[model samples]
Target: MDLKRRMQECDEFFRLPELAHLVPQRRRAALEQLEQTGGYLQTAEEILIGAKLAWRNHARCVGRKHWRSLKLLDARRVRSARDLAEVCWQHLQMATNGGAIQSMITVGPPRQPDGREFHIINSQLIRYAGYRNGDGTVIGDAANIRLTEFATELGWRGAGTPFDILPLLISTPDEPIQWFDIPPELAREVELEHPEFDWFAELGLRWHALPAVSNMNLEVGGMTYPLAPFNGWYLGAEIGARNLSDTNRYNMLPLIAEMMCLDTGSERNLWRDQALVELNRAVLYSFRRAGVYIVDHHTVAKQFCDHVKREEAEGRACPTDWTWINPPISSGLTPTFHRYYDPPDLDIRPNFVRRDFSGDGGI
Candidate 1:
């Protein structure tokens, strides 16, 4: 992304009444800076609002209703990998907020003119280590198998548990890849238990409290920050329906169905469907029982619909991806699944872009 060119095209950056008058001046300065150094630094206000606008413009997110509440942490001056890790650690604590789970983004340094940038290897700040065994079995989240192997190659080891927290992995232009153990206290987790199922706790299922995506690049105005980790609280279906129940991930439905004595002899019995609902119930119950912030799919879908209405009232188009904005389970039951929306526009500025996990064997 080129900041100079983006400045000329994206008027959202200068849309605020406070910044409107300075658009001409800012645009001129950005062009001058680009000619001299091939980049321009964004002001604090620009970064802050830009991050929020990015969230608002993210079509896949169902939680965009709370975009204005996003908190920003400017760490653009962080020079070393260790310093980046330290700030990321602080980001976890702040975003977790003792389970209140504040929405936040910590912007690391922008990609340099030399084409080098900082990187956070883990897709999420906290993820279960996935150990792929020689026998084709997996011990943890199957989705993270490559990441676990990458961490192990870096000399990090886990207890070989089903839900071991993976170490934070990062890399810099000048340094080799590095890993750090999240302080035990900072790695908050909620033990899963059904509110009424006495044996559910015995299943020993748990998930980390935070869902920070650390590997995406934040593209605001014309600058791209490769290490801007951001997070919000969980949407229960994300964990219950996709993470745990997905066939390739934890694959917990079969065990849970067997435990529930659900009839599995025939697809007509809808065993997987039954297990899915119960599993989602357990997840919602567990998080709420543990005082962690989480929302049920129905409620979150309603909020998204509401957000779309608000955006319409403002004469702004709310771009949305139908598949992503709808809940994975019982999507037809929500209002979000009932209507069409503006298709996602990839050209939107102040957006978060997924980082390509290639080279150096990084995942």
Candidate 2:
């Protein structure tokens, strides 16, 4: 987009009563630089506010109620792929926070005038490697097949397990892609077990505690921080209902159904539905047992409602995507499923945008 125009829009946003606490001079200086050189650097305060606003403006997120609590780390001064990878590891350590899971975003160096920038290849900081067998079976999270193949091409190898964590891949303009293994301690995972069913633990299911997304670009003011990885605590359904249960991913429903001795011969039996509920219960039970912070879909939907009300009280509309705001399971039972919201606008600045991973070695 036009850099000058976005800066002007951002300048006006800061002038609003809610953001008046931020010094106006920084924006003036940025505007002056843009006018003279056709580019400008965002000050730390601008970056922080922009990141927070971006989260607030993100339509797909149901966790926007905690936008102000996001911790912003300006890593623009980082000079190499290795340094960037190290910062990412540190981000993991900090965000994990011994299972309390702090909300955070790390803004890397902004794109140059010609659009060259660093980017993390992984969609999320932590994801299981998906190994496709010749028999058309996947050993891990099938959703990550592309990334897993890319990592293999880069000489990174996995232990060939259903829950093997993939290495981090960082790409810079002029450097070869670099990969880093997340320190084992920082790759915290919760082993899933049902409180009522002891046999559930035999499934050997687990999931990472953090959900830091690394592949999305952070568009703030006029600059695009391509390596801005951010995360929030996960809603239980994301892991339980979608990740573990989705057919395209681990596809655990059939196995769970068989183990429970449920009649899955027909769709009318609702075996999949019963298995889904038990899997969700196991996820919630396990996280709580492990002392890792997690929220249920019902609770998050209520929080989303509160967020919408707060945004309305400020005389601003809360742009929302009904499809994403609603949970995958029992969506109709939640408050978010019953109401219409302001239509989402893609042009909103200070927002996160999915990065294109269509290039060679890309995910």
Candidate 3:
């Protein structure tokens, strides 16, 4: 279906009986008030309807019978306007699931504490932020750093790993920052440097990281902050890279998968799987630190599926693994280094010695 027809279908879907309950009456009332106060009523209607359908679909996918039951939109528990906005976000997620799009752009705060390590991760996040489309066209404009500097000046501490940065870069309270483009080599360097940075290594990756960054950025009221070389190289890389000749590779799906492999181990055991999972967790942490959502694997898979669908519709041969374009480290781009030292495992018990001071008591 065409974009307009699909949108119309989406609109009609919201009016369906099963989905109508998902729309909050208060939201409708608020929109009406805004419209009376000169808000664009038609636009508001489209937004509200879209939000309702999105929430309904999301809830349904998760086997939820009502929108109120979902943590994202429970009115009784919703605390802020941001939380309310997530009700609309459910639509983006649903769209991805339905193969309508490969990715939905979002902006937020870094997932790591505001420190050197966070800055490194932020740098990598900046690199990925440059990811673009085919035909040498940019995706979003370059991410704005002035707002980030402003937030830092006002003392906003960020959280999460690199991937989370996208949201923050895109969603600063001021004007929207355009997405920038980065060269592949520079992107690699940023990834390598991220883990080597200190601030990130100190706090250690934890489950609560992303949420913490998001909460802190929100609390600080969108002030700009001072980001180190992370922001600089990111911007430089975006300016330096040429657009990919092939449109299929533009998604950078393989790059993400490759990074995932790098962060994990190869042993054929639970430890290996666990390590890989940690890598995934770390990536999410990094993205959160960068002030963006870590679009889950399920979302990425859906995107890949969408690409396949599009290729089929266009009567072109769809490559099964565009990820191979970047090539894996094992394929020889990285140099091998042997360990200089291997420490032996040892177990020791502590013993206490009593000191004798017979003459000291008398003194």
Give TM-scores for every candidate, taking all chains together and pairing residue i with residue i.
Answer: 0.96, 0.96, 0.24
- Candidate 2 structure quality by residue, lDDT tens digits, 172-197: 98898888888899999999999999
The C-alpha local distance difference test score for the whole of candidate 1 amounts to: 0.88
Q: Candidate 1: give its CA RMSD in angstroms.
A: 1.7
Please report, in order, the local distance difference test score of every candidate based on alpha carbons.
0.88, 0.89, 0.28
Model 1: residues with Cα > 4 Å off, grouped in runs: 1-12, 15-18, 21-23, 360-362
Q: Highest lDDT: give the candidate number.
A: 2
- Native-to-model Cα distance after best TM-score fit, residue 357 in candidate 2, in Å: 2.3
List RMSD in Å for every model shown: 1.7, 1.5, 23.7
Q: How far is candidate 2 from the true structure (C-alpha RMSD, Å)?
A: 1.5
Candidate 1 displacement at residue 101 in angstroms: 1.0
Instruction: Give every collision pair in model 2.
Output: none
Error of 1 at 114 (Å): 1.3
When 2 and 3 are scored with TM-score, the better candidate is: 2
> Residues 185-268, candidate 3, lDDT per residue (tens digit)?
222221211243343334332221111111111001111111111110011111112111122323332343344444423344
138: Cα error in model 1, Å: 0.5
- True lDDT of residue 137, candidate 1: 93
